[model samples]
Target: MAISKKNKSKVSVDGKEYLWWVFDEYDQTEFDGIQIKAVSSDQTHFIKYGLQQSLNNSKLVLALKNYTKLVHLSLPPKFENNEGVITKTGINRMIKWCKKDVHHIEYALDGSRNDLTEAEKQLLLKELQKIIR
Candidate 1:
């Protein structure tokens, strides 16, 4: 199901307007995770990132950082804590990553998905090794 327009937040990225929203997914009574979904003003491009944990501002920042690190992309700017809710800047960062050629493939407009690819896993392993060194 598509996110309702009333629930979505709007942001302008690089002179283009986009709409984004966070939705909770559930496994029956149990809570799954929250997915951040965004689409261009024209609706031609869509981005979705799922976090397999409960939502909060700190966790959202960490998830964005970890995802970018695994992809060998620069970490997104720190987000403001707006009462523990996701902020527009955080959504903007996701949109930026979505526009990149390398990262965009992982968040396909077609909706087929995986949390991480084997190559990304290996790269993250190497990064971890470097930090441990």
Candidate 2:
């Protein structure tokens, strides 16, 4: 079996819904939250394994620090009186974060493309295609 079984079906704990996820290799993934999966099965597996490994060797403090950094990076510039704009520093930081977070193979496969202004997106798409191809 693929091991997509539920141990405690539809149970609520402390007003939060939790699901018990099992892997065919006898691994268990339990959570009270939802996460978006990658479109490709290989990507999904790679991401899940990476997360599980990180959860094992990493401290909560480090996780929290990473979360805080992500939050800071995600915050709108308007919060700092920049009016919801991303400065060059912000873009550089974002690119740095991506370089650190993403695997080289995946990065090569899918370049830095996102829903930005048409001109920017086009430029990113062009560069991405060049790298990917």
Candidate 3:
């Protein structure tokens, strides 16, 4: 939380809007993404959410759940990388960090190193956003 980058943005879900802050811990490395702090439009209170992984849509879901008093966390679809981001030897360690999500959105499973396209990423985000509402 000692980090000083004050990134903020507005997000709309279920016809309602919210404000969020992105900050990383002082000890956290650049590879680790920042945590999200968000609050509703009314500003009654705030929520600090950290999911311990990368992926924009998933992180957004974490924020929406913490910001509201309702049960939104269970709605966001969980995801996992079929083939590990690391080498075979380090695969298990990375998978452990993925937090037991499903691999519905397959990546690198077909023995190809192709990166995700912008359109594909947007489509996935759209699918995830659908559950947020």
Candidate 4:
């Protein structure tokens, strides 16, 4: 499905502009969470993130906290904008994650079958800290 242009917002990351939009899959039973989609202004790079619902908490507090860590690494929580539009930091993080071939984080708090390994997570975290600053 094509995302309407009116629904997309603009953000620039690393001097490159990107168009981003949030796809709320309310009827989706598998993940039961929103999907953030973005593409570079030049249409060269595309990235998507599935922010799945946490199995441990229905309120999404724990899920979001963990997701923030997984998605943004050590970056502050302010980088995430939950109110429909995505923050610039969030876009940058998504691009970084995409380049690493990392996508969504499962809701398993036990770290079972996650997308990123412990070492990989640490590496990405360090890289994010260095670049995002």
Candidate 5:
């Protein structure tokens, strides 16, 4: 006669918090005690991993300095002054620091975007690399 054994329960690694993350989605990602970095509530950010600028812009700034030659793209004129309100927008524009730049790809994809000489694909690759490093 064979003795019946009890069914084994599934085990989760690093308990339920850390390991359980991969299968789930997070709205905000924390770093250095701050939730400043946002983790998309989707799979792409989870599946594809690396340094996202939302986590740290300094890293990308350093990468631009290292990989590309010296080039100063000035902040948009509208943002040149008025200190608090305009300066951030100006800086963000020059670096394409966040979604603002990426959002344009959608608009331009429809053919309304001017400045056709600068190809969208090329800009996408270049910006993606900057984000990666």
Candidate 6:
């Protein structure tokens, strides 16, 4: 993994504190050392979004489980666009590429495009704020 620019800081917002860092992968090496924690699940979602944006590789597509290990891959445009006959068989293939023991995270194994819930949007906003700052 190549870190093009590194920014590490502590951000406090609305009486909450967070750790923020940015990375850039100039090389193809795997990026696996990112660590973040939050006081609540909502904050976790925000931190994740901020971290992901800093490591901007348009081809970067990660399927995470339980907020721990992430299965990173260079998914084709087909997958990103949610096209193709995403069947049980196809999902099985995708699952094969998953990290075992990562549990209880939201996954569209069937390759469906489901809208984020209100709670998810709020968490995403928190994440966006971290990046904008």
Report lDDT per candidate.
0.48, 0.24, 0.37, 0.48, 0.25, 0.31
lDDT of 2 by residue, 1-133 (tens): 1323334223222232322222333333221222111111111111111112222232110011112111111211121114533333433332233223322121111123323454443344344323212
What ranges in model 3 sit over 4 Å off?
A: 1-6, 26-33, 53-133
Ranking by lDDT: 4, 1, 3, 6, 5, 2
Tens-place lDDT digits, model 3, residues 34-133: 4545555655434334434545444222222323221112222222234412222232222222223332332211113236554554444344334433
Candidate 1 — what's its lDDT? 0.48
Tens-digit lDDT track of model 6 for 36-131: 222221343222221232323412223222333222233322211144233333322322322222222242221243365545534443443343
Question: Model 6, poorest ten-residue lDDT window?
Answer: 72-81
Q: Estimate each model's TM-score.
A: 0.47, 0.18, 0.31, 0.42, 0.21, 0.24
Candidate 4 lDDT, 1-133, residue by residue in tens: 3435797888876677778877777565322567666665655334455454343422111122223333332211222556645666776766654344333332322234357766665554444334332
- Clash count per candidate: 0, 1, 0, 0, 0, 0
- Candidate 1 TM-score over all chains jointly: 0.47
| Number of colliding residue pairs in model 5 | 0
| Candidate 1 lDDT, 1-133, residue by residue in tens | 3445897789998877778887787673112566666666665445455544333321221122113342222233333244546688877766554344332122211123336665655444344323312
Give per-residue CA lDDT, model 5, range 1-133, as digits (tens). 2212233112221221110011123553211221111122221111111222232222211122122321111122232234423232343332333323332221111123334333654464355434422
Work out how many backbone clashes candidate 6 has: 0
Error (Å) of candidate 5 at residue 47 is 28
Error of 2 at 103 (Å): 8.6
- RMSD to truth, every model: 10.2, 16.5, 15.9, 9.0, 17.5, 15.9
4 against 6, candidate with superior lDDT: 4
Worst 10 residues of 3 by lDDT: 69-78
- lDDT (0-100) at residue 25 of candidate 3? 70
